[model samples]
Target: MAVVCSKGDWFVSSCSSTLVSVNLKQTCEPFVFDCAKAEKRPKETEGNNKSSEGGSKEKDSDRILGFAVSSSGKHIALTDDHKRLVLFCTEPTWQCISTRWVVRRGTSLVFTQAEDEVFVADKSGDVYSFSVLEPQKPGELKLGHVSMLLAVALSPDDKYIITADRDEKIRVSFRQAPYNIQAFCLGHREFVSTLLVPTGHPDWLLSGSGDGTMKIWHYETGRRLQSVDVRQHGILQNSDADTEKRFAVSRIISSPDGRHIAVQCEQFPSVQIFLVNSGIESCLNHAETLALPQAPWDMTFDSQNQLWLLLESEDINVLLYRHSEQHWKLCDTETPELKRVTEALQAQANVYKGSVGLESQFKHLYKVTFDNMASYLQKKQERLEQQSKKRAANSSKHNVGGKKCKKESSPVAQSTS
Candidate 1:
């Protein structure tokens, strides 16, 4: 199930390459943008032809990779599997602002604090900056990493750009001068999946990883403030449960106020909330562990600071939680706005029910580890044997050739005698 996010009155979600944005205010109809139906722009088509033949494969399957809304909630941007970045304006009404091509498929999208530029991190370990004002302008390369970048986020001050990669590293770089490395938040045993610079806590950075841990850092200096073992917080898994997934943090989001942090594992039915006790020396204090009736496919906190959960079940597809008086209380499921949003997203109910993606999505991301020493020794032995066989064959060929040459010389000598 695609993650659900909200911007002001707009509650947006994506399925496949299609984006569905509904106005909870009920003034605007549920707006849908399907990349499949998008007509090729002459300029974009011409530019596509100019691209090197060594570009991303034409999967013909255009699916939304990730999307983000600006902090002001005035703009929303998304990248699709077809190497296209689409932006939408959410002012008076939802309208397509721009559709541009990225150098490669984007893994994450983030808007700078200025909201004038959108930064896209791709599988090639590079980040690109696209202009929000100049819709027709092409993207410019910002920075590069040695390994594939999984997530990218901007500092609240827009001075630093934080990036996470498949190489199990989080890099903090100067946005204006990317070459000037700020610090490296190291220690995640596995690839990091999400990065967030919490609201109000400008210097603090939170990251969730495949290692099933959440690490907080003083992003500028790269000093780790705290590392939380998320797996340990929840119930112990049975012997047969997958070790990596029982605790891997697939998603971590902070409330707009940055007072609460929500962590979830993919397809897991429980969400853990941690209270941020912010000060000069701040850390995460465990608040509550919520066990849901059905495994939530995705969830997000709205602009109003209310949590919205999209579950795997279709009958009760949505749940809302309001934090009142220091307690999270469940809201009525029969709200009018929720009904409209659900009706617009009814087509994706079956897709959400499909457990294949939910269960196996993060499973493939974890690097499969084996004994490299054993493998190396085995390969070395095979190479030595192959060399020995080649040497024997070469020696036999040389001997045969020598013998034949000697016999021909002997026949010539006998004829001369």
Candidate 2:
């Protein structure tokens, strides 16, 4: 369980998959359990020699593919590779409060703003919503997509759920009463890779596609507002001399203010940010570039509006983009204290059966470190921008004086002649 958040607290699950939880309000110590070497020891209880449910937990029962926390940060909803939906309450401890098998092979999980429930999308092209607690059978919503559902997103108001599929279609559904299928956003000619709802705008939804286009649309009205074709920007020109340029939209994200949109494309060699609503617009507003060694899987913006990008490869690496500084900074994942904690938790996970002790610890540490680094870099970028403006002003003044000297010399030379 690798936990990621705005704050750098991370947890690694028994399966070595990490979930980093950012945006944690407080620091909490974690318990690490190493499943590889862990053994279950049962103690007789008062009820007819019964054992504690916690002690009798099963190891490797679930493998999480994607997970998300509620807006309140009290509830966590996760989707395992087996397409099971599991919700947990994080206040007391990491306990499985509820488990509802929503999809036969679930690929993604998205939570509403209220945190009362989550929407699970499956590989077989089925979507279902289940309550966070109490009620069992989930309300089923059968979706027909040409291919698998690739990405899912919830609106800011949580009134609508937007899903993108491999067939390059986006479906918007109302979350409440009617629970009606609102509209199908059709534009991309290839598989859709990601979907995003710009911060503070509940009405706007953005989609990125393998067709190399980043499209912004009005969720409620199903109107195509704007389309940004990345390949036309000339940033990903094929340098093979004879080979043609091939680019696919890897990820698309909008800034917190909704004033800028960022796009990450395959083989593009960098990330690009575009100024939205600005008259000076380009497909790729080459503000900054990140020469990533691998393809980026996902990107999220924290409260400070800094972008934390993750790569989903065997060797995972997270990078933070400093927009003001126009550079990409790699996250420091090698702190001695963090390393010690991680190692300890990993060892414990190997020793405990059915225990999520190590996963919780890894999640906490990941959240803390990622959040801290994002905040620090955001401030650093602001300072650097200020310094850059100051230098530019001073340079302009120097150039003006040189021009005045040239004018004064011109009059003297003319008079002498």
Candidate 3:
């Protein structure tokens, strides 16, 4: 629910409808923007989903469902549970630029490489594009799939729009002419949860799914280069049987240089690292796993290529990791920038309830397995028992018939003697 993302000098996250921003390169207090407290802009035309008259108050379900930060760190956009697409400008300072309505709830959002438009993917399997230059304009329908879209991304060159759905399919379509299909990356056995197009690798695309595996792909051709089963690393060990069954790849992020990849499961306490080796035949080598005391809700790489972790803890909510000597070392969270962000979040309105201990989003989404072998064996045993009973009855009938004939013959022999 509470996922964090960063680009350029800004690391922003959303708690329900309210967005929290922390300037990574500056020592300024964090800023919070609540959609409920802001004024709604007038709609240009009536939408299929009715808009409340006079900017009716936000509903209980109006939490920030999806959010994205521009590559330049100058803009941010978030969609709420209220079917609203809200945009913000952070360069001049955190300010609400526009609030518009969507026909359905948004699941994932991203900006194009040019940062001219923000693409929002909804649970209804539709992709809508909203223009940043025209803030008050409604989103135009792009392309759609038959299943609920779990993740959406744009290629580095902004030529392709990639989308993943519950049907375990990754589609690469022309961004402008979405009707023209390019390729399909089809290997996952379960619902896809996240998609990533690494920064330095223009042709490479990475994806994670409920199947507990991550795959490397060439976006244009849909060729799978390598597939890594994260379960092999034992990053999902737990005593709870149910929790283990629900494990899936929740997030996948990579460094700006495309040398390291961090893959995280839904509620696991550890993160898996994979080293991407490029050569004549490039492949992924499992690097290591970093265990934490608590499960992290999200992980992201800033422009500096360092990892920032958002944890579900009371004492501290964020941690920084620096790469040194081929290992990630925990940096002290006492830096002025981090301290200001933490303090500001703690001091802000009592809305810092981390998305922990809530009902998991993947509970019902996990594939259900049936014990077909067990049932098959039981039916075979029953059939054999019935056949044995029939054979025994036939044998007893034959034995009784022979005994009657023998008794009749003995009586005849006695009479003759």
Candidate 4:
């Protein structure tokens, strides 16, 4: 998974037990830290030993759950499946500032608006907050839910802490005093996978879920303003229960200008775009749909609002699309640095293998054909329309000539009589 920082840097979570950093210019550097080797608190080792004993030498606990970079882009916090929280400083060098162990495995991580504190939501439905200013101290439990927390975020002003759980509920609580519940944005039929607050629109909240819908809400009042069903645009049909459950909306990203929203679903190659405006009844107007070569694993918009899509394929290429002339166009140019990063990730992926390699290659080839077919159909439609217009013009001329001949023949008949 690739996470775009506020400063336009990329943090890639690798399965090779490392985190890679790509700078603004797309230069790749390995920020190596082995959680297995990191020193843990005395009490934390017992749980680690037990988890390792029950699983293979490669425990899932070693994998990273989530990570986030601070607003200043100076610090980063990441959580692993082993309930280990590691904070790093990205300035002079990528150094691990501190390592704090949590009670349960974390599902999501986010830094506060001021970047002074970082919050981690765990599988046990509890939110823990650790002050970045103090690295040695343990994290304090903030708030929790009855169900597993899937996502969390803070309001731009840091007024409220919003959280979502597997039960399809989004809770808004006071940032300072989380016990005082503010509101619950409840409308999702399935687990809420992601939450985002638009840049300029602090009052509005955007959420994507397993229900195949993206909803816009007024976070303060907990009002459901609109819901857009994105399944119609993709191959996932709502009627199929298995398909609906499998193809949930994985990510929803808003443009920097807050005028457009981009949505991606799991295993879907198509990216849906929506327009945001006050008078709009539903944001599902389908402003534009971009067909990607591979299903996107992650996506983000840069400072210039150019959409970047990271494909989940063998090559793992990043595609950039820019809006031009009332349409979204893919730039054919590839930066050398970006190409190098893609090749590096691809090499890393090849180290792990299964029978799916051949199948994925075929899928990529099919996607190319699909794209060409779409272009061919579009041109074919235009040609057909032009031929229809020509036939209509010729028919109108024939009608005018027949009318003139009828009039002349009528005058001749009258004179003979």
Top candidate (lDDT): 3
lDDT of 2: 0.58
Q: How far does residue 74 in candidate 1 sit from its true spot (Å)?
A: 1.3
Indicate the residue-level lDDT of 157 in model 4: 91
Query: What is the C-alpha local distance difference test score of each model?
Result: 0.81, 0.58, 0.82, 0.74
- For each candidate, what TM-score against the reference? 0.83, 0.62, 0.83, 0.75
Model 2: runs farther than 4 Å from truth? 1-62, 133-139, 142-147, 177-179, 232-235, 238-247, 255-260, 266-269, 278-286, 311-316, 325-417
Per-residue CA lDDT of model 4 for 292-345, tens digit only, reads: 777776777766777767676555566777888878888664655446545555
For residues 28-118, write the lDDT of model 1, one tens digit per residue: 5688888777645467664663474365456545778899988777899998777788888887767888888876778999998899999
Compared to the true structure, candidate 1 yields what TM-score?
Answer: 0.83
- All candidates: CA RMSD in angstroms? 7.3, 23.9, 8.5, 19.2
TM-score ranking from best candidate downward? 3, 1, 4, 2
What's the number of clashes in each of the models?
Answer: 0, 62, 1, 0
- For model 2, how big is the CA root-mean-square deviation? 23.9
Better by lDDT, candidate 4 or 3: 3
Residue 122, model 2: lDDT of 68
lDDT by residue (1-417, candidate 3, tens digit) is 577888877878777567888887777767788877765534454333545234445353657788998888888998877677889898777888988887777889999989899999988799999999999898899999998998999998889999999889999999999999999999999999999987678898999999889999997999999888887675535444353465689999989888899999877788888887877566678887888888888889888778888776655477778889989988787866566656766664355465457777777776678799998999999999999999999999999999988987896777988
Q: What's the distance in Å from true for residue 282, model 1?
A: 5.2
lDDT of 4: 0.74
Q: Is candidate 2 or candidate 3 better by TM-score?
A: 3
